[model samples]
Target: MAEAARGLGWHPFPGPAAVNSVRYQNRAACAYHGFCDRGGCHLDAKNSTAVSTIPRAQETGRLQVVTEAHVRRVEVDGEGRATGVSYLKGGEEYFQPADVVLLASYTYENVRLMLLSKSPAYPDGLSNNGGQVGRHYMTHATGAGVLALFPHRLNRWYGLPAQGVAIDDWAADNFDHSDLDFIGGGNLWVYSDRRPIAAARMPTFGRAPRWGSAWKAFVADNADRWTNCYIQKSTLPYEDNYLDLHPTVTDPLGDPVCRITADFKDNERRIATFVQDRMVEWFRAAGAVEIIRQGLGTMGPSTHAYGGTRMGDDPETNVVDRWGFSHEAPNLGILGASVMGTSGSHNPTLTAQALGWRTAAHLVENWSSIAG
Candidate 1:
C-alpha cells in the first residue's frame, strides 16, 4: 500500500504499515468527488470520479463535462422525447441540446432533478409521469462494532478505510437464512484502531470521568486500544421508503434538494441484531476484554444508497430498462447505483463503475437504436 501511494506521488502518513483496516462507519468516506474521510484528501489522493472516469470521458472531445453545471430540467420535444437539458453554468442560464440526455448524477440527485423538471408533457416531472421517480430509495442497515482492549497494540491509525480483511461469511447468499427470521445478512469486519477525532465521539461508557484526572487517564489508556467492527447488511426496497423533492430547500442554483424518508424494517433489524451478536463473538475470540456493540440507529443519507430509478423489464414497475435506458424518453440513459434493483453486500462503487462501463458500451454498440 505504501509503495502504491509512493508510485502515485502521494506520501503516506507517518508510521505506515503494510496492512491495516480502519472503521469506515458506512459514511461517504469517498463520495463522487473525492475522499470524504476524517478530512478531505488535500492532494486528491483518493480514487474518485474527479480522478478516474471523468478524466477519460473528458479526453474524448465529443464528451463535454460542464463543472458547476446544475441541470434544472430535461427538455423534451412535443412527442415526449428528451432533446436537451436546461442548466446553470457559471451563474448563466443555458440550454445544451443533445441527441440524448443521460442522468449520470448520483442516485438521490437524479430523482431530485427529475421531480423539479416539470413540463406540460410531464406534468408531474420529466420521465416521471408514473410517479415512480423517487419510489424505491434504500440504504443498507449497518451498525458499528466496538472492541474493549487487547494485549498488544495493533497500531491501526495509518491505513485506508478499506485496506484490511473482511469476513463475508454471512453476506447475501453466502449464509442460509432458512431458519432465521430475516431474509438478508451482513458482512462482519475487524478493522484497525479508530482515529483520535473519530475515537473521541465514542460513548466512553460512562467509565471516564468528564473533568480532570480520570478523563485524562481514560484518554491515555484507551486511545489506541479500540477496534472497529462493521456489518454491511442487505437492504430491500419498499413502497413507503423513498426520495422526493424537498419543497423547503433548494440548492444555490434554484434546484430542489432531495429528501429521504425511511426507517429500518423488521427484516433489517433482525439482520443487524444477528450481525451484532456475531461481531461480539468475533471480538471475544480476538481477545477483547470488553465490547460495546452498537445499536441500530435511524436510517439517513447512506453512501450505499440506491434504488430511486430502478431498472427492470416492466415499464410500470421500473423507470429504466435493463440497459438503463428510460422507457418513456428513449434517448435518455440513467447511470450509477440508482438503477440497481438489489443492494449487493459489498460497497456500490465497484458495481456502479462496472455498470457505467457496461452502459457506455451499450451506447457505443446500439448508438442508433438509443440515440435516434
Candidate 2:
C-alpha cells in the first residue's frame, strides 16, 4: 500500500498512535490481541489516562476520584465566578467547592453543563453572557469509507486499529486547492484490525444471497480476503451548525440534553467525493478485485466531536480565551475538544491532551491571580 501510494505522488507512512510499541513508563507494549478495538486493553498498553496519568496523580495523595457521580452544574458566586460543582451521587446531591474549576467533559456534556448552570449574575448560562458557549460546533467529516476485496488471504487476523498505513497527501491543506470547491482534504488509513463477528457481517458484493447456503459460503471464503480504508476529512465550524439544550427532550434527571443541529455542508461533501475517488484508485493499485464505496451520510453522533465552547481571543465569538479559561468566568477553565475551533483531518485526542496540559500549567503558573 505504501508503494502504491508513493507511486501516485502521495505521502504514505505509518499512522501515529498513542498505543505503546515498546515498554514505556512501566506499562507493557501492545499485545496485538485483535480485541483492542472492542474494549480496554488488559495489558494497559493503550496509554489511556486510567493506566497512565490518573494512577500517577493518585500516587501524589492529592487527587480524589469519585466514581459514579453525575455532575449537575457549576456553582457560581455573586460575582459570577465558578465556586465549585454540584453533582448527584447515590441519590444525594452534593457540592464540592474549589478555588479553580476545570471542565473537561466531552464536547456535548461540556456545553450542556455550562448551559444548564444558569446564574443570576449571568442570566443566560455560565460563561454564556456573550451567547458563544455553543456557537461554533463541528465533527470530523468521517465515515466515508471504501471496502476492497482481494483474491488471496491478507493474514490480517491479529492487529490493532492504530496499526495502519496512512496517506496524508490529501489531508488538510497539503495539496493546492486553487481549483477545488472544498478547502480541506482527508487522511486515508488502511489497517488490518478484523474481528470474527464483524468479518462475518461483510457484504456479499452482489455475488451471493443475503442468507442461507450462498451467504455462508461467501463468508467462509471471503472472510479474510477483504479490507476497508478509513477517510478522516477536515471539517470546519459553521454558523448554523451549533449545540444547544434540547427544548423538549429531558434526561432521567429532568434536565435537558444537548441537542446538535449540524450537517455536512457542500464543501464537506465535495471533499468526501474527491477523497473517495483517490481511495478507490489506491485500492485498485493494491490488487483489489472488488471495491464498495459508502456514501457521505449526514453527520451524526461521533467519537470525534469538537467545538461548542470554542477558544479564541475575542469574547464575542468564543466562550474561552486562548488560555482555555472562560472568557466571562475568569477562574473557570475548559480542557477538552470543546475548546477546539476547527476539526482537522485527524483524531483530536492528542491535541485535547496537549491543551489540557497547557491549561493546567497556565493555572499553576498564575495561581494567585486566576484562583484569587
Candidate 3:
C-alpha cells in the first residue's frame, strides 16, 4: 500500500502531460455537502476511473468489459481454482471463462458476490472458511452546522463548496490530543451556493411554518443569505456493525442486496459533539448572528463506504494480503474501498485508484508467483 500523500504536501509541479485547465463543469448545487452543484462535472474535470484506467483497460484487447453484465457467481474448478464467472445480461445468463477471476466490484457488492457463489468443496462459501466475509465496515459520520439571519446580504450563493476553503486544523494528527475525549478530528468547511430547489428545503430553524405566506416571505428574505458549515468527522468500526446478505430482500435478478447493520460508538458521538461545537465557534467568528448546530444522529448510507475484505498480512484478520491478493485464492485479486484497512481523513476515490494501480502492477511484475 502507498503512503497516503496529503494536499498539505509540497505542491506538485505540472508535468509535461498535464492539462493545466478546468476540464469539466458541474453546476449541480446539491451534492453530499453542496459540492459539485453544477448538475455534474460536464467537462470531466473529476479524475475518476470513468476517465482514466477503464479506457486504458479497454485499449488492451486482452481485457473484455461487459458493462451491463451483473455477475451472479464465481465458477470454480475441481481443485479449488477459479475458472470464470456466471452473469446475467438482458434477461439471459452467460458465463465468461478466465484463468483467474478478480472481483473489482464496489465494497458491498464484492462481499455479496462471494457469498452468492457457493460450491460443494467450499460449501460455507469461497473465502468464508472462518466466516469473516462481511465485517468491519466504516462510514463517515456527518452533520451540518447552519447559521441564518444576518443583518446584511452575504452574497452566499456562488462558487463550488470545497473550492472555497477547508480548515483541517482539527483533522487527524494535526492537533494535540491531551484533553480530547476522542482520538480523531474533523475538517471545517464553509461555502455558499444553493439552488432554489435546494434552498426551499433548508432547515426552518423552528421559526417559519412549513407552508403559507410566511414561508414565502422567509424564502424571499433569507434564501441567499444563509451559510452552511460542514464538519466531516471520522468514524471507527465497531464489533457489532457489518454488512451481510439481506435475509428477505433480493434484487431484480433474484440476488440478495447487501444489508448494513451498524450503530455509532461513543467515540464517534463524542467527536461529533466536539466538532459541531468547534464549527459553531467558527461560524460565530465569521459573523454569524444566529447559529444552529446539528449533531451526528443515527448513521445512514454513506458515499464513502469502506472496509469489508480488508487487506492485511494475517488471514485471521483480513481477507486480502497487503498486495490486494486473496490469501485463500492465489489467483484472485480484489479492488476498491473494501480492501482499505483504515479510513483516513481523506476521500477514498483517489487513494483507491492508486492502490488499484499498485495492485495491477504487482500482478504484472510477479505474474508467475501469483498465478502459479
Candidate 4:
C-alpha cells in the first residue's frame, strides 16, 4: 500500500484499518470480510456511532438520549425563533424544548423538517425567509471504469473500502481543464476486492457470454482476474437540482417524504468520460488482458448529499450565516453537509463532523447572545 501510494503520488490518507465509525468495531479490529459495504457489522468490530459516541454521552449523565425519537419538525415561536422540536416516540407525540435548537439531521431531513415547521413568521418554513431551505442540493456523481481482467492472481480477497489507492491528479482543479467541456473532474479510485459476489458480477469482456454454463465456468476461472476503477466526480449544485417534500409520498406519520429532484449535468458526464479514458489508459499500461467499458449512469441519492440549507454571508442566497446559524431564526444552528456550499470529489463525513463541532463550539461561545 505504501509502495502504491509512493508510486502513484497518492498522499497516504490512511486512517484506522477499519472504516471510521462505530459500526465495525467488534473483535478489536475490522475483519476485512467486505461486508462493511453491505450490512451492519455483526462482530462489533465496527466503530459506528452506536458503539462509540452515544455510549460516551450516556456516561456523562448530563446527556439524556431519547432513543427511537422520530423528529417531525423544529418548533418555532411566533417571531420565527426555534423553541425546540416535536418528535414521535413510541406512537406518542412529544415536544422537547430547549434554550436553543441545533439541527444536525441528514441534509434531506433537515430541509424537510424546516419546510414542515411553518408559521406566520416563516410560512415557507423555519428560517426559510430567503427561500433557500431546500435549494442548492448537490451530490457526487459516481461511475465505474471498465473491468480490468489480469492473467495472474491478485490475492485480494479481503480488505475494507478505505484500503485502496486514490489518484487525485484529475480530481477537483488539480489539472488544467480550460479547454475541456467539463468544469470539474473526478478522483480515480483503484481498490482491490475479491468478494465472491463481486467477482460473479464482474462484466464480461469481449465476446464472453453473460449467462449459461459457459458464463459460470468463465466466472470460476477468472474470478480473481477482475477489478474495477471507480470515479467519484465533482458535481455542482444548479438551480433545477433541488429537494422538496414529495406531494404524493408520505411517511407512516403522514409527513411528506423527502423528494429528491436531482440529476447530473453535462459537466458531470463529460468528467466521467475524461476520467474513464484515463482509467482505461492506466489499466492498459498495467497489462490488463481485457477491459469491459461501462458508462456513467444517472445520479441519485447518496451518503454524500450536500447543500440544502446552504451557508453564506448573504441572507438572500443562503439559509444560514457564516457560523451555521440561520439568518432568519437566530437561535437555530444547522450542522452537517446541508450548509456546505460546494461538493468536492470525496466523502463529506469528516468535513460534516468538523463543521458540526465548529458550529457547536460557536454556539457555546456565544450562547447568551444567540439564545436570546
Error of 1 at 43 (Å): 4.3
Cα lDDT tens digits, model 1, 277-334, are 7666666665666677666754646668898899999889889998888877888899
Model 4 spans > 4 angstroms off: 1-27
Q: Report the number of the highest-TM-score candidate.
A: 2
Tens digit of per-residue lDDT, candidate 4, span 113-167 = 9998988989888888878888999988656556788888778888776667667
Residue range 68-121, candidate 2, lDDT tens digits: 999999999999999999999999999999999999888999999999999997
Candidate No. with top lDDT: 2
Tens-digit lDDT track of model 3 for 298-344: 55566788888888898988888988887777777888998987676
**Residue 157 of model 3: what lDDT?**
60
Model 4 residue 183 CA deviation in Å: 1.8
Ranking of candidates on lDDT, top first: 2, 4, 1, 3
Q: How well does model 4 score by local distance difference test?
A: 0.81
Write down the worst ten-residue block by lDDT for model 4: 16-25
lDDT against the true structure, each candidate: 0.72, 0.91, 0.69, 0.81
Model 3: residues >4 Å from true position, as ranges?
Answer: 1-21, 24-40, 60-62, 204-210
TM-score of each: 0.85, 0.97, 0.85, 0.92
* Clash totals for all candidate models: 2, 0, 12, 17
lDDT of 2 at 186: 91
Quote the lDDT for 136 in model 3.
Answer: 83
